[model samples]
Target: MKLLKIIIVLIGLITIISCKNEPKSLSDFKSNFYEIQHNGLRLGDSLNVYFFENEDLVKSVEIIWNGKLLKNHTIMDSTNTSLGINNLKIKVNLENNSISGETNVPILNSFKETLVEFEVVKEYPHPQELFTQGFFFHNNKIFESAGQYKKSKLVTYNLGSTNYLQEKKLDDRSFAEGAALLNGKIYQLTYRERDIFVYDEKTFELIETLKLPSILKEVWGITTNGKELIVADGTQNIYFFDEKFNLQRKIQIAGYASIYNQLNEMEFIQNKIYANVWQTNYVLIINPVSGAVEQYYDLASLSQTKGSDDVLNGIAAYGNNILVTGKNWNKIYELSVK
Candidate 1:
């Protein structure tokens, strides 16, 4: 009888000890959860995340990404996430503790071959002396940044009438390239001077001079999506920056058959980047995030109208229209993309 009683007591003690070690919920051991490794992943790339925890105490594991639950992830294995243009939020659900974190993984867009051509809606007289590098439209007016030492200037003109409205001559040594208008300021890039000149949008007066990143040897073009500025040099690389000129990201332009280099003069429209290839009559429409060329427009016939020395350079979006011009070109062509 005593032996039987002792056996019952031992079994009950074992059951109690097992129940005490088992976690009822994650909150009981939340402090023990720790992230081992988390990394930023690119679009189309696999995501590998790791964490350390007491596996026996964990009742269940759930992973959530971008508000959606990921069902097929191993506890310590890498999982492929879907492609997107924004940041990713990850939430880990444990029986006792739920932890969350974020990753700044940029999912590059897939490539699509879209063929398009341009039809001239209207042709306006452009200044033949202005070696146009960058162009933009603001408040129904055309703003331009022209290059060439001692000749570089930022000028504004009335769109249809082509009447000169304002002009600001840069310093003799400054050869201006691309121009972007944001807030109430005009940001102009210099060719070899390695300076970004800022001006008052309304008055066209020089406001400040900022230094370019040392990695960029030549500033070719610049445009903005209202919040951030996108700049390009002579290479295939394009850079994204905040309004304060802080580097945010970089993209390498990829063409269908080759890597498109010598990208000059850019325009951002409808989430796509249109860039003019230096010394070529081709304009490439690129996916900004993925660096893939979705389509290209050949303006060889348009170039025939200009002088032999003129090179296709500038692009701008004005209202519902896109405009194209070149260095020393006498006319600006309004384009219709099909």
Candidate 2:
């Protein structure tokens, strides 16, 4: 009876040990136990991932993006990822030689391309000496900001007569780039000085000077959606700023087949941003929210009639008309979108 009791106790100990040491079955393992930490993901950004499974249970992990193997670890980097929708799959190899079920993640940014052309409606005389950078129309008046090392100026004109109504010369150090008229203020940008000059709209008096974020080395174009301001550098990125000039967010502007660079003067029309490609006669109509080029308008014919020194750069919208001009061009052409 003592031997029998001893044997029974030994058997119970062995059962407990076997249960504790046995590997978890496939059904017990959960796939995608990891969590991805990000509020939102954009193109040219890196995604950091975290896993919840025990390291001892995981032999290896594989991450796939858009049907391509991205990494073999928990953290996946999307630095060179392309724009648009992408599929992601995560697979984990268990220590017991079993694989977990694949986890599917959908990363998406809807971007599409559209083609557009324009018809000339009318032409208005523009000063040939003006190195036009920013152009806009408000209250029956046309406001233009011209740039050159020592010749940068903010000038206003009567829309009908094209006669100068007011003019203010910028300091020799300020190479003015773009301007936006909002409320009772006019905001102007400089090329590399990082200076944003604010002026009283009615009096043209200097109101204040604001500095841009250090990351924005060059300020090329600016526009407004009534409240917030949208700014562009020479690259594919566009920035949004609040009423107080605080950086809100940024997006990479993508075209049909490639990313649009050298984005210059900009104008806001019906929620879309119209920007001129520097040194090109092509205008990109961009959807600001998605950073997609909705349409491309070729204005190459307009430049052919101008002097060799003229380079397409300015755009503006007023009432029911869209106007386009260039640096030192003789005329501003009103466009009829077709």
Candidate 3:
């Protein structure tokens, strides 16, 4: 009878051991186990994510925020996040079971951009027929890239010259967007074509066509700082590429309260990037490193001077003055914002 008792006790010990070693199952582990408590994940803000009552149950937490992996972080610092809907993925590794979920980040901030006023420096005659997609100053001429299905072209004219210096038209299928004169070569972007046309600066002869990265859905604006090319794709994101068209990095233009979108024509000057928010009369002066809008210039007065209600879409840096124009607009107004 004593041996039988010992055997029964041994069986009970085995049952307890098995139960203790077994992993706990959580049906809602991936669904409602965590919460993000911060100032709505704003730009330049850090995130604080925590599991409500399952902190002890969590063995480890891994996050993929904005397409970058972050270990031990529920969601990484938003200072490295994009402007609009940033992608987020979280995985919690428990003692035995592992679960993961993906969601979009809600990056809402409550701040306003500083409004900077402008005064008209001068006015220049711009071609009324040109659907200007890009505008910039190189040497003493204005290089413009116009966009349309069959009316796209690259044309150059002096700031005060009525006649164009050189004109090169694109084939019907290619809609030319932005152009920049870089290293004696003119790099022009084509909308929806995924192609960059390289040309000789003087002769405007087509040299070679480079393919754009697939990540950039549509190339809108193109510029250069004498070394790297800055590109925009309608969205708030701006991309930097080397002279060989290799992507170096990307930044999203963000204001204090909202993520600015429709970033069309771009020009880099005085170590700052000035971008035209498409269809709006706002020119955002952006900090290239932190992707913050330092100030914004309203072109509503200049926009109202247009013959038609075309969108203001062109910006060229001229020493201390900024030249602005729009599609099919008759006059280009040079402004002194300082």
Candidate 4:
């Protein structure tokens, strides 16, 4: 009750202060939460949401949307949220220990429609029978990064003749998730490992290991844009780094599908970034400028699921066609834009 009284006094103080001219940043004033949506959302679909209270104090924020609470890792206080097309108001509660404040949330709609479709032409000629996490093409050659508990390896193969080119085994049990050639070295990301394996590009020999940020260790995918190296982690955020491996600004992919699809294998093509959602047969083509997903390719038919085969694990651009493959699949297909 004492804290409530203090809050009531502060509210009164703010009300009086607002009538006079004042200088304040966003935190100094009550903020309104705007609803975000795009044209790609389906009816009954939900997405992740974050709330801020103060500087360096953004933790578990409870939100009441359409009179229901949510319970996801991203939103535990949420249970019943809106979906499809509808306008709703949300009450954002910021609990600062004993004192709290309420903010208003406004509803919005989708930005663009999502596209997902795929068809398996044939399997890759080689049949080693392993789960692939990353796939890249260079000069008609296919480079594959395999993932498993203890059977992980970085292998290269000739796509034209289906001949084994080379193989490099991991020293530790940690499986390699993604690999990219930057400058003349190969930088590799290890799943759940804070250590990054660097290799000589030409010889494919292990060079040295670099440690990632001390804060996070669950690295997932990696790619290069000629100048800087971009990476994705367990969280749906992408980080940029220079040749020295210094931490740069992070790009947050905020959307309904971005919350849990688990962005895997990343590939840079024609100034855009392409990533595949793990365990699903879909590839997301994103715009680096706005972090908006421009287009999506559905690879559901590649692996054979309920409606189609599920071969949408890896995505790469070879010349003018886009090649997509999946875990333990035989065929690597070349697809034209639809």
lDDT of 3 by residue, 1-338 (tens): 99999999999998788556543433343334234422455654555445545566677777777677764434334446655567767777876567677766646433566888778878989898889998998889999999898999999999876589999999999999999988899999999888899999999999999998887988988888778999999887889999778899987777766778889888998999999988788899988876778889988877843444368989999988889898888888989876
Error of 2 at 247 (Å): 0.5
Score each candidate by Cα lDDT: 0.75, 0.76, 0.80, 0.62
By lDDT, who's the top model here?
A: 3
TM-score of 2: 0.70
> Residues 1-338, candidate 4, lDDT per residue (tens digit)?
99999999999898676544232333332333343443343323444444343434333445444445544333211133322232333333323232233333222223553784544444456334646677788866887777776777887788744566788888667877788878888887788766788888778888888987764557777888888888878565677887667987655454444343367788999998898776676677776654556677766555543322233567777886777776666667777664
Each candidate structure's TM-score, on Cα atoms with residue i matched to residue i, is 0.67, 0.70, 0.81, 0.65
Candidate 2: where is the Cα deviation over 4 Å? 1-58, 62-112, 160-162, 304-309
Per-residue lDDT over 164-224 for candidate 2, one digit per residue giving the tens place of the 0 to 100 score? 8999999899899999988889999999888999999998999999998886888999999
Q: Which stretches of candidate 3 lie over 4 Å from their true place?
A: 1-39, 52-87, 106-112, 304-309
lDDT for 172 (candidate 2) = 95
Error of 2 at 202 (Å): 0.8
RMSD to truth, every model: 10.9, 9.8, 4.8, 11.7
How far residue 67's Cα lies from its native spot in candidate 3, in Å, is: 7.2
Tens-digit lDDT track of model 1 for 179-276: 99888889999988888998999998888989998878888889988888999888878999987799998877765345677898999998999998
Rank ordering of all candidates by TM-score, starting from the highest: 3, 2, 1, 4
Off by over 4 Å in 1: 1-112, 304-309
Weakest ten-residue segment in model 2 by summed lDDT: 30-39
1 versus 2: better TM-score goes to: 2
